[model samples]
Target chain A: MNNIEIKDLSKKYAGFLLDKISFNVPSGAIVGLIGENGAGKTTTIKSILNIINSEGTVKILGKDSKAHEKEIKKDLGVVLDDSFLSAYLTPKHINSVMKDFYQTWDENKYNDLLKQFGLPTDKLVKDFSSGMKMKLKIATAISHNPKILILDEPTSGLDPVVRSEILDIFRKYIEEDETRSILLSTHITTDLEHISDYIVFIDKGKIVLNVPTLELLEEYGVAKCTKEEFSKINEKDYVSYKKGKYQYEVLINDKNSFKKKYGITSIDKPSIDDIMLFYIKGER
Target chain B: MIKGLLKKDLYNLASYKTSLIIIVIFCGMAIIGTDAIYWGSVVIGIIVGMISLSTFSYDEMAKSNRYILTLPVTRKEIVLEKYILAIGATILGSLLGFVLTLLIGNIMNYVRPDNVIDINIDTLLATTIGGLFGVSLIQAIQIPSIFKWGAEKGRIQMFIVLFVLALIGSGVGFLIKESGLSVDIAKLESVLKNFGLFLLILLSFIIYFISYKISYKIYKNKEE
Candidate 1:
């Protein structure tokens, strides 16, 4: 079952356009939406939540985002980077307030997360560090046992140890329910390297690639060779190429087949970051 | 959903700790100022209006307003909560005014009988009702503009609203002087009696409801 299905998602700003984007996060899959800043990642997430007036149909848990928006959202947890808690509210105040928002608010889980995150129940959120605030937001998101989680740069500004812990929490969150899914958007491709089952590369509002992470790892490779050697390889075989002062690195969709045909030996598996850089900035 | 939104706003409002100071200021003014008993409801009304509008500033203070939309509530519910908060603030303000008037009047009676001011219950009722009407009128104009432009931008609109209302008032006063039956307290009371207090309450609510509808419409289409 698909937990989220966004079809023909389009939003226009004064100078930028989020062209018709279509993708889905199947049940139990982590789909990472990777795009540079101003690449419409936030806009796409906002459109999915109906937070912005966008032209598209977003289906969450098989329900329309607009007509069934309320019901659909009851089970959807969303966290945004800038939308941290108010400075005056303590964790205790947040608990009471969230109790009103969710019918199945789990007090025990919230307290446990607060304890684990090293957050004081009585202290104001404003007094917490940026990393602490991020943890608090994630804690709130998971406390309700959401069926779907949509996070925009949820791990930004956190230390490596904390980011890893948050990722572990996400892993446990998904493990709790097989049908639960997550759509996480971030430029930190390393975070998605291990967790994301699918990678959707978006650049300039258009989806450049939507493939399983395993498929991306298995099918894509970067061939580092001399400029003369790179020139010999068919332009049709490589998706993109980057020219350094010393060497040329060409990216190919199918390394195994290209190797057999071109006899090029220096082929390494392309990381999600490499693929993103090549797609967004590499030469034709 | 409206309850949840209101709970969040109410919590935020209380945490601000500014409401207490505003109330204290109102009390201070009431105790020392002349005709303070009569102006209690008006002061309270303004306090409520300011607090209710302050919620928007808080919501916009951070991108928390955007965060809130990700919750299960509709944009309509969020807007509805603001109206509810406004109503709550109005009641709180008006009651504070009324209670202080009585307490201050009674205190003056005991401490200095020579300085005691007798505040009529009928006048109090009329002012409370009038205060609610005045606040309702201000909100009806202010809320829609706030929804269209945020709190910062709406500040300019707020001044413009006050200016327009003043202009309208002076224009009406000129019209009355030009072709008038004698306008006095007796005439006003007679007109009020004929128009009916219940009718005024109903009219004010009707205008408030329209304002809420307009605010919701503006907020629904708004992009964060």
Candidate 2:
């Protein structure tokens, strides 16, 4: 079962538009929304949360998002990169306040997370380091034992140690409950490679690719060939190509099929970042 | 859900506890020995009532409105919580002011027997209710403006609104004077003396209700 089903969700701003976008976060899977800055990742997340008024439909846990927003939200845990309850509140204050919002709020779990994260209960959130603040946010989000987690750039601006620690927390969160799901958006593709089961790539307000992470990493490849050899390859077989001084780097969906068809075998495994770069900057 | 929102705001405002206590004490001390001791309640009431609206600034500072929408609370509940906080603060502030004025006035009377200031219960009650009404009017105008704009921009817009309201009031008064309106000072004073406190409290509630409706309308479809 899909935890979130967003269909043709669109939002229009003064100079930008989130074109018709559709994706799903299946139960027990991590769906990472990967895109560059201003590429509609945050807008898509906002649309799912109903924080913005957008066109099209969003279904969360089988209920219409708009119709059952409050009900759906009870089971949703959200963390935004730049937004939280308040910067002035301490961890203790947050625990006190959150208990009133969720009947399922586990103060012991929250306090345990805070202790594990080394976050001071009395210190104001504004005074904490970015890493500490993010840990606090994640701790707050998961303390209620929410069914789904929606995080926007949760790992952005954090150092590798903190980022990996956070990723481990997410991993443990899912491992604890097989029914739980996570949909996180990040430009840091490497983090998604480690945790995300599926990748939904968006570029310039449109979804360019959405596929399983293993398929993207294991099936997709970059073929470097001479200019003359590149001319021999059919455009239909490759997704996109980047031209270089020495050769042409073509992105293909299937390396094995391309090798069989073209009899060329210099295909390199493409990273999520490489695939993203090729799609955004490469020629059609 | 509103309880959670209120607690969040109350915690945010708790940082002002020391400042608020200092200000209240200062106001009480400054007015305790004076004949115009009644102004203490008005001053304290206005200060406390106005400070409650700073919760909007706190929300804006954190950009928590968007985060709040993700909670299991409707836009109506979010808007209603603000009104509850604002109205609760206004009433609490007025009550504090009334009690402090009475307490300080009696203390001063005991301290300076020769210069006893008459702390009239009715007058203090009227001033407290009148102070509440005045603050409610400002809050009524300010809250909707804040919802339409933002905390920072809304404050500026509210001042402009207040300016226009002031100008309108002056214009109406000038027109009345120029039209040679017959004065019924004694009758008007009698009516005010009888029902002024009740009218002020009733008007405060009515204005707050209208302000809440306007705020809800602005916030219902607002994007973050």
Candidate 3:
């Protein structure tokens, strides 16, 4: 059974829209949602959690998300891009508050995370730095022992050191079982590049690609060649191109065959960001 | 859930303890000056009612509703907890205010016999009932507004509610005085003796229950 499935999901805003986007994250897989600003990554996460109204069928753990929202949320963890802590509340206060709302909230796990993140339990959340606040949110989300973790841009605006620390936490979380899954939405494709089993690219309110990370990288190649030889290659086989004074960079499918046929000097592997940029620009 | 929510509210309000102390002192002064302890108690009760409304507004402004809803709790539980907390705060505040008023009254009586003021049980009961009635009505209207339109718009709705209540109170007072009926203190005492407790308690519970249902519907359909 799928861990999460979204079908024909659509939400329309005045300036931004999430078109009929659909995808599935099978049980035990880490899926990365990659897009630029205003690409509806957060919108999709909100719709799945039923935080926003949308027209679609969203199923989590084989149940409709809306009909079983409270029930489903019991086993699901969510961390939005921004902090939701009340200015006056401290980490200790939040723990007591969570005890009342969640039946499975683990106080030991929560306190352990606070120590791990170096967050002061007695200090008010408003005084915390942005990175600290994000750590607090992550602590809260994981304390309930959720089966699925849905994070939207959790690494945005944080320093490299903090981002790596958070990624380490994600890695630990997924090590529990192949049945546990994570749907992480972020602009920092490098973070996903190391850990993601599947990458889903969304742009202009629509999904461009949803495939295994390794297969996509194996099939697509970024080659550097002279302008004359670059033009000689078939345009249909290439996804995008960049020009230079002495050389040309082009993204083509079947890297091995293209390398042998054209005898290119270098065939570089495309980063997740590079793949997203080329697909978005070339599609338009 | 209700206990947790109440503790959170109380924790947040801990920093305002000095303000609460000042308000109690002011109420004591009002009672000593006016020599009408019951009316002074009524003033203190109204102040506490306003504090409850302000707390609800603060929660809205902080987007606490959205955060709480995302947790493993039902919207119905959230709405029910707010009603519980509103009533709990009102009761606790009114009890403290009453005790403070009595202490001040006794102190003044010992200092100056000529200005001594005595508060009867009936007076205390009347003030408590009136305070609860006002609190329940305020929450009944304010909760729905916050759920429907959010904090910024809810503040406007709060002012509108207060204005409407003021107008209704004035209109009722005018009719009572203009009717030329026997407006004796004995009749008022008899009315209180017969049904005031039942009426006040019933009104408070009914208003609270209705508000809970309305708030639940609004919250369930709310777009975060």
DockQ of each: 0.68, 0.91, 0.51
> Residue A5 in candidate 1 has what lDDT?
89
Model 2 residue A35 lDDT score: 93
- In the predicted model 2, the residue pairs found to clash are none
Q: Model 1 Cα displacement at A77 (Å)?
A: 0.6
Is 1 or 2 the stronger prediction by TM-score? 2
Q: What is candidate 1's CA lDDT for residue A252?
A: 91
Candidate 2, Cα interface RMSD: 0.5
lDDT of 2 by residue, B118-221 (tens): 88998898888899999999999999999999999999999999999999999999999999997899998998888877888888999999999999999999
In angstroms and one decimal each, the interface RMSD of every candidate reads 1.4, 0.5, 2.0
* Docking quality level of the chain pair in candidate 1: medium
Models, CA RMSD each? 2.3, 1.3, 3.3
- Candidate 1, residue A219: CA error in Å? 2.8
DockQ of 3: 0.51
lDDT score, residue A112, model 3?
Answer: 98
Could you estimate the TM-score for every candidate? 0.94, 0.98, 0.90
Model 2 Cα shift for residue A72 (angstroms)? 0.4
lDDT (10s digit) by residue, model 3, range A1-284 = 68999999999999877989999998888899999988989889988987789999999999999889888988898887753636688999999988876799999999999998999999998898999999999999989888999998999999999999999998989896668899999999999877888998889899988999887778887888886887788876677887767887788767888877778859898888788877776431
Candidate 1: pairs in clash: none
For candidate 1, give the lDDT of residue B174: 93
